[model samples]
Target: MNKIADYIQTAKLESDKPFCAFLYDLDHLRAHVQARVDSMPANTRYFYAIKANSELPILRALAPIVHGFEVASIGEVRKVRSVSQDTPIIFGGPGKSDEELIGALEHNVSLIHVESMHELRRLNELCAKRDTVMPILLRVNLRGPLPTATLAMGGRPTQFGIDEMQIAEAIQLAKSLPHVKLEGFHLHSLSNNLNAAEHVKLVKYYIERIKGWAAEHDLELSYLNAGGGIGVNYADLEDQFDWDLFVGGLQPMLEANLPENMTVLFECGRYNTASCGYYAVEVLDIKENHGKTYAIIRGGTQHFRLPVSWQHNHPFVVVPSERWEYGFERKGVEDQQLTVVGQLCTPKDVLASDVTVPNLRIGDVILFLYAGAYGWSISHHDFLSHPHPDHIYLGGDDHV
Candidate 1:
């Protein structure tokens, strides 16, 4: 049996309540991230976005491999610092408070992605107060004929970054500010972009645009922050982001159009960590309601909210368990389509919908795949005050 199945079986033997836990394969994570880092072209860097999974074990595993970390809040910055104090950190988010800005500055963050004109000024003012000159990347909301992505933070009216048309003005402001140094532009417009060719095309577009802007403004820039949106195929695990294809296309583009001494940075969250994590919950009950069958699990959206949040049937496997402690007829459904739900009162507590499962019993564990990123970290854990699932890490230097 695979590690997930093996772990589930072991947990069933140990626990009588229900097996609900997040199992992270550190060996798999390290191998996957190392492959991605090794495959990147010259002058290219990969920064793991901590918003995906901020667990300490995950951070420690990735610290040596990734070039740096991309954080959204001060809390994330502190988390990275606790793991590796010397690792470079780039802060980026909307509605950043004064304390967050101060924290970023005091913590010696390598870069801060300025979202707006007011934010730029605010950061500049904060830097002046500290008597420190800070390097900043002006995040631009490009006006583009861009490719379709799962989520768009730019190329539209969103509370993300400065408008492309107003970028020139923002650059001028940054230059005039005494305490802030303009590094480059951050064009992280898309989220969950699956097409490798289209992503390479987007990178080319970013390079050309930035080159034009540098010439026009006479701006000496070093970093080009291309936000990470490489997507995961939740529907089909077999179909995934072609990293080799992307690198094949990207290497030539960077070598041809990239400016001299410019280091292109990719801050990827989901793509790096999603595959190495699994959310396994034991089945509490199995029954047919009206015409459809419902296999209720011990956990729900509160534990793993990716399916309901994305409105897609997350991929999973039913780990069969032989142990049945109840003194009654064992409930099960064989070769039938079922909707997996959690033990929540609301109807929205769904994990997988309209999925066909063969031989799913009441005691069997449902292991949801591709759950490393944005699973437990983004969930409402306090909802209904249910007991939180145990976090189990497997096969790493530090296995806790």
Candidate 2:
């Protein structure tokens, strides 16, 4: 199959609009997800986190492969349900309204991860009103010396989960609640932790802690939801998480140590989808300022904002172009650092800075790879009234 970026570049050449688009390769997505699924050991399940890329076609393409989905809001619940009827759904977030709780109960979601004692009580009351039992996993803010990560939430006091000091109290409260069943704990501590061994170690810590709690409370937990923070190498495009090494380390450890009755679930978002998407934008102008080359593109952070959020030089390739119409000498620089900026008026709209690339000119396309996950969804599309780039789907004949 053609590289996703190359395919997108061909499509961009055929289009008349300002050359920019978010292209998703369904074939690549399917293969990537399937490989991850296949690598996982038995008793472990995979759930696609819909917050990564909630596009209808992306959801539909992934529904059949994943066991279920992890949604943060009621709208996501509905969206997942629209694509899948039988697949299980798990709801988790810092804040959830009474209406959302009721809706989740009505939909019979597989599990609602309780973020705090208050949320636990709220869910209990909501379940009581419906006269139905609600299954839940306590989202714990593990007070820890966790593995170093790009973003760490578990070891600190964050809005994500219950404090580690209160687990015993939370367990007693769970016992008192009649409608809510605390089946296990959700330990989602880090974001983008790349080390496979470190991830395995984190999971081991979660199991030991949860097992100790279950034994102390004399409770038989069903599952431990390790909130997914699987990393993607955004800084180096060729580098990726060593899934083989991860699985190799994880399986043996689980086989020897993990409790036989408990199952593990990984609700991965970015790692599952990032590799399949590409964002391509055409250079509208090229100029030199203060000994620095700047290539301004038609679109900026409004359409692709992950680079700015991560503050990394997002990897890209220069789709070299020879199309030049100007009678005057064209501006071109070779083997020099190029700072890529979007059309947004603000200076903070830079996508990449001080990156060495081939000479660039007006009409040359810069295709940003690995933009499938948080590229468009987290962007400020309406910030400056810039036209949204076409969201094109590759691998299938459909164009959006």
Candidate 3:
């Protein structure tokens, strides 16, 4: 049985207003993360990227399972600290204000990914002012024939990391800086890459490049941060990223090529938590417009914006509502193509585009899956100033 549907039904009985909510299964999230961690090879670590979902409950649930948290801002650093004061944090971002750098230093961040020469200089200065020495990974924008993914941060012109050609110069400068220590390289190239074989090949390429750099510079680095791009398949949930195959291919390559002392780091965000969440909204109206059917819900992109941002019809299930308090007949559509939209004023407030559904009604609930990661975190919550959806957690001690 669908537990989320039961909760939505109960909520509907308790209130007359149209409703929307983000429901997270904490037990599922914990188990999913644990499986990922357990499958990792020796000398490899998994870091949960906090930018995906920094909700306190999510962080608290993930803290015990992950090796550490990968944070991109001072606010994220503080969020992690609030949950686990001593949890290791790897701070990585292109634009870091002096205050944020200082905050990372004060919070005792385990490793900071330095993006540029100027940023490196600034960090060294800050450390010197505090009479402290900090460990860092020089984020490199690799020059390459790289694997194709949904989004590419490197292998092109971007404001993400230092260029590959400039890495030698950056290293020499880091050697001169008294308060900053260079530990390794951060090569986070792609986002939402689903092909497992291609991903393994990419990792192999990263290792070979890092090894060459280490030998040339005569350095013994502690880590090779291959920033995570393992993706979840929203188009077809059953055809997910092949973790077993990826691990099978990766463990052998790491054992053969990578140094025993160094650790390989993966900071995954979407794949870690996306499957454990569902966005539920009540359909308010069914209408026909220019030979097309549209079902308008109580929520909009303001609440959950992943589908619109990606321009893909997010996968969902319609939970039929049995109760009808209206004097008029309940209106619905059956065996027709439907476009699920939200209650926003703009025409772009669509969740799922023209897709065929068996049955849908005015009071039915639409529950969107794979919403635990970028769904809420990347949304413009105050766009139309609609009342926020209820954030409900299930099956965990921290449930509320």
Cα lDDT of model 3 by residue, 1-400, tens digit: 2787888888888898886899998889999999999999988999999898999999999999999999999999999999999999999999999999999999999999999999999999999999999999999999988998888999999999999999999999998999999999999999999999989899899999989998898988999999999998999999999999999999998999888699999999999999999999999999999989999998989999999999999999988888789999999988899899987889999999889989899999998999998988899999878988888888865544
TM-score of 1: 0.98
- Each prediction's Cα RMSD? 1.1, 1.5, 1.0
Return the clash pairs for model 2, or none. none
Winner by lDDT: 3
Candidate 1 lDDT over 230-264, as tens digits, reads: 99999889999999999999999898989999999
TM-score of each: 0.98, 0.97, 0.98
Worst 10 residues of 1 by lDDT: 391-400
lDDT (CA) for every model shown?
Answer: 0.92, 0.87, 0.92
Model 2, span 1-400: residue lDDT tens: 2575466556656765668888888999999999888878998999999899998889988998998999999999989889877789999998999988988977769999999899999889878887888999999999888998899888876788999999999999998999998889899999898899889998999889998998899988989999899999887766778889899999988887788788999999999999899888989888889988899998999999999999998988877656565698877778888899998888899999998886677787888889999999899999879898888887666677
Evaluate candidate 1 by giving its C-alpha RMSD to the native, one decimal: 1.1
How many clashing residue pairs, candidate 2?
0
